[model samples]
Target: MLPEVNATRYVTPLREGGSLPGIVEADNHGTYVVKFRGAGQGPKALVAEVISGELARRLDLPVPELAVTHLDPIVARAEPDEEVQELIRASAGANLGMDYLPGALGYDPVAHPVEADLASRTLAFDAFVENVDRSWRNPNLLIWHGDLWLIDHGATLYFHHNWPRAGNVAQRAYKWDDHVLRPYATNLATAGPALAAELTPGLLEEVIALVPDEWLAEFDFPSAEQARAAYLGHLRTRAAAWPAWLPGAAA
Candidate 1:
């Protein structure tokens, strides 16, 4: 489970994405980019964030620290925006917080080229998760201290939105032509298979177990346990058929 922290202050809204996640100061004195559970995408987005971000970290991809944030609606009383205020009030319980990375710059492919190994691994990871947001227009890749970090995983795990047919989409092919790191993923043909092999049942459960039960309860399942089982099954199925969807997968 992610560490729990109480939000002490709401600094400013980051207008980059639709969810309007904001920067916050926590009781632990740590700064974080908090994603509210009341966001338009709902708690499922937060679930995807925890699963994908932490899973990426375990796989050696750079990801900011994720924590379960406790927020009080009163913290936004002075905010002028009605929209922001309503969002704060509705998110009066547990939300998601990611450690704020200071002085990080947006990644520019031409200015910051990645090595083949890292690029291959990154591409493989996205493919395995069925991420659709890592395109050139919205790379979602950041450069902090000369290393690349992946962010905003809410857009991955698309099948969750339609649970009944999730299995149909499990092994669906990943179209990587527009992937931001496609050009540099020279070793994907070799790396993809090796990386897929790493998503064993044990490791999959480790990452899935990190997701909070409250968030899992919102899914269209009989119980939170079933939701977790669904996620496990979907991911395991996709991982097993990686060669069908993974670009440059080896024979």
Candidate 2:
């Protein structure tokens, strides 16, 4: 399970995205960008962040450490902004926290060219998860200490929004023409197979296990276990049929 920490303070709100994530200080003395469960996307977005971000880390990709943050109602009272205070009040529970990158800059493809292999693997991973947020308009890629890092995976695994149809969309093809990394991911043919090999059922189970039970409780699944099984089933099916979804694999 990811380290669980309680929010000690709400530093400030990050207004860039619609979800209204905020910078918070935790009891561990570490600062994090917190994605609230009260956001419009709900707990499912947090689920996608954990699953997709952890999977990226397992694939040797650069992703920040994730933690489960506990928010107390008291934190909301300290916020002066009415809208932000309301958001904090509603999110008085488990939220997703990403390790804050102090000096990171947004990735610019032209200014900082990525190597073909790394780019290919990133593309393949995004495709596998059906992430649609990594477009040129919102790259969602960061550059810290001269290395690339992936962040903001809340938009992934869209199938979960309608669990009943998730299995049917498991084999859906990824449209990569708009992917920010597509221009540099020329080696997808080789990268796809190599990365897919590492995503074993065991590894996936381990990653899915990191999500907290409370986040899974609100779902309509018979139990948290069933919801987890559904995630595993959807991802496993996608992995097995990579040719249908992997960019350049059909060539």
Best by lDDT: 2
TM-score of each: 0.98, 0.98
For candidate 2, write residues 12-121 as lDDT tens digits.
99999789999999999999999999999999999999999999999999999999999996987778999999889899989999999999999998988999999999
lDDT of each: 0.91, 0.91
Off by over 4 Å in 1: none
Show the colliding residue pairs in model 1: none
How many pairs of residues collide in model 2? 0
Lowest lDDT block of 10, candidate 1: 242-251
- TM-score of model 1 (CA atoms): 0.98
